[model samples]
Target chain A: MDILDLAFMQRALLAALLVGVTAPAIGTYLVQRRQALMGDGLGHVALTGVGLGFLLNESPVWMATAVCIAGAVVMELIRWYGRTRGDIALAMLFYGGMAGGVMLMNLSDSGSSANLSSYLFGSIATVSEEDLVAICILAAFVILTTVGLRRQLFAICQDEEFARVTGLPVRMLNLLVAVTAAVTVTVAMRVVGLLLVSALMVIPVAASQQIARSFKATFALAVGIGVTVTVSGTATSYYADVPSGATIVLFAIGLFVVLTALATPLAKRRAGRTAAAEECTLEAPGERTAADDVRV
Target chain B: MEQPVIALRGGVASLGGRPVLRGVDLAVRPGEVVALLGANGSGKSTAVRSIVGQVPLTGGELELFGTPQRRFRDWARVGYVPQRTTAAGGVPATVREVVSSGRLARTRFGMMRRADKEAVIRALELVGMADRLGDPVDALSGGQHQRVLIARALAGEPELLIMDEPMAGVDLASQEVLAEALRAQVARGATVLLVLHELGPLEPLIDRAVVLRDGCVVHDGPPPEAVGQHALPGHDHVHPHAGPAAEPIRTGLLT
Candidate 1:
């Protein structure tokens, strides 16, 4: 209750909640497309935007959004033309953006590694009044896209070719996915930090899929787990004095482990139930194959 | 002469700098079941995919339902079942979910109404996969996966159905079920174009067979007589009294 009194703490918790919801919401589609690490690429590129913001004396969040959207579109284009070598290209983009960010930060007016570290590792101080407003706006966009077009997104992600013939505006929808993913990356940058944001995007969905039978269930369960870990991680960081971003990411990984362990027993139980009710039997034809049924 | 449902003229396609479809011609009239047959690397799949706009045509004229492909926007009239690749994606999805996506053609803005849900179930029932609706797609056997894919195509109830290797890797029992389902689709005035390596049970249903060899149409007419291996497209009949190079390039044309 006392920690809630602090303005920065309030902003930080609110931002964490938004990150928890939006990360896995958009992440479900990315995972379905098997582009689970796309958020990682966007997050790395956003570092360049943050650095540019510092050099230009502007808001890093907005700049990161613009830059990430551009990077995501470029990545999508590379995917179209360079299918075999897209990974190598993405690797170049990632490292180049990261190195450029470091170089640009050194040239900025506040040329200090400490200033950049706050954004890289996620400090509570980064969620200023203005940053919170920007996060809210960006998160709103992410939520709307992910939820509003869930079926369309699911169709495209599940089977791009099938969706194309279904007349799904497949090309435009693909670009939209890239754009939405970029928005989500920047939305999470303040709370989860650029380095650790992908974990929140990927791990929660991974954990949920272990038990979820359908894409819809996987999505709902992943968002549930995301909200659980992020909120608790923020509270732990507040009382125990730790980095909020790392704490939240570690919390998600821990949940994934627990769910993975639980998946085995749950799977065994379901398998047993289905096995007991099995209708089709391996009865070889014309040889009284069922004779062994009673004998065995 | 009725306007063909699918009209491809001098269709040319390439993969990795190699011309897979070099000046190929194919057409399917309304309510006709046409099977494109060929051996591996014969460009049969490429030709079918090109008509569906899945493959890039290097040079060709493609018309779907009397409209040029570039301007054709009536996709609800077309259903495509792509050649299944073992590309189980990053997350699990139920069989029903996958089939429901096929009904996206009939929906507005991807919203599934009551009629759409019924259509999905009806499609599954047509393929005898209604029972597995709740099961995860990855948990199914290969033959069952094929049935689900066919069901997905059937869900849209398209005027023209394009399938690639719907029977590949499928069990004989599943094949019979698929054959029966295709029969029903034809009975209802649906046109079909499929790519198959062997005619098998589908031989009786095919109104015509267009065989491709080295990216060219080598045969086009009534379904070939499936007299053992003789009916197989690109089946090489080794002659007893011949030189060491006894296996000649014998497509369905020579048969």
Candidate 2:
């Protein structure tokens, strides 16, 4: 039977596709808000939850999801109250989470350490039927919430003070973003693993922003890039005997590098053209200067 | 007597445990262009922010259009232009998209109606940014960015327009365009409250000036004549000879 016909391979691919779509969908906002590392912070917290599960002999995925949501709320509160020094609080949480996870994992049995390692690097062959169902349900919730509040989220991200002045419930919308980010990170952990899930959430969005002109276009293109990278990376890892999470993240970084290299010259050329057109229309024919043609 | 469109009586507010506004009283009648003048840290921005409910008052009363601020729900009736900063943040939105977002309070389910789109276009035209509606805002100059923000506010068709330092970093040409735009809005009977440093081109349109010094109202009448004479050296020091009560007014001129 071909690899596609194998049940484990089929499940892994489905999970990859689902995460590939949702991670960057939520990530577009995170990247725009300059909070790209929020996903990584939540992912670290999820690892702590997984460690707790190992200690208690429970389903690690469910525990991780719950802990991540709670951690996200805490982070949001810190961001609100800490004001200018909010990044310090986030950094504390980021390091605390990783340290806590390692300590908790050490306290658990040695056999479970192997399981934790799989979650760290991700083993596509190990995604069970139950994990697939959980991911689908959570992914659906994330997508729905994000779609319902897209405009409000965009407004808050653009300018929080202005959004508040407009009576957009800026505080509530900010909390919603944090919760959605947490959910996305939790669901993505299955595919890219806790340590590398942030790559799936941020890289494609960064790549798309370089080329896309508007917010909507950037979001659409990021999703496209995300799905392509996840699907191809999964297949490559399967055939090449590589760690799936690392392979997928590396693939995304490579694509980002390529897009960045191509975007600069194209953007400069387009800007020059627009500048020339503007000068031609706004200035008198006799008064037009050659200096106006030079791109700032 | 007709009630003022914006009334902040005994307005006291604090930020991070530091008192910013102390028993400040301001009232703007309908159709009047009022300028809030003060130097940096004079609490002019904080006072307006309190009116918009962004800054919580430690002890005071703010009323918008005859309704208590706590009970006011008519957000579409108010337009706001915050002080300009580097517009680099979040997603790169097109000029049209940014302006369209201004109408959100008036739209249901965040869906823009045809009328909403028309208003956005009209607002852009008002600011002379109609030709660049599809351009990303980040690519625009500081002055162009300010105009886009003003257009965003105007798109909402607010009865009351509150702008904080709208001309702070704008170029002279853009300032003229903004002044003309304000003239049109005033002619249309929109109530405007502007926080300004020197008034500049907008000086002619201002009917009343409320100058603040260390969070207290020092002058509340015609625009200070000293401001128009800014070209003279030591203009700020040439204050009207008066008693101790006039000290705050002299300090306000230092702005």
Going through the candidates in order, the fraction of native interface contacts each one reproduces equals 0.61, 0.41
DockQ, model 2, C-alpha based: 0.30
| Local error of candidate 1 at residue A247 (angstroms) | 0.6
In candidate 2, which residue ranges exceed 4 Å CA deviation? A84-88, A106-111, A275-296, B85-90, B227-255
lDDT (Cα, 0-100) at A243 in candidate 2 = 84
- The deviation in Å at residue B204 for candidate 2 is 3.0
Model 1, position B243: C-alpha lDDT score: 45
- RMSD over all Cα atoms, model 1: 6.2
What's the lDDT for all of these models? 0.86, 0.83
User: What does the i-RMS of model 1 come to?
Assistant: 7.4
Each candidate: how many clashes?
A: 0, 1
Evaluated against the true structure, the overall lDDT of model 1 is 0.86
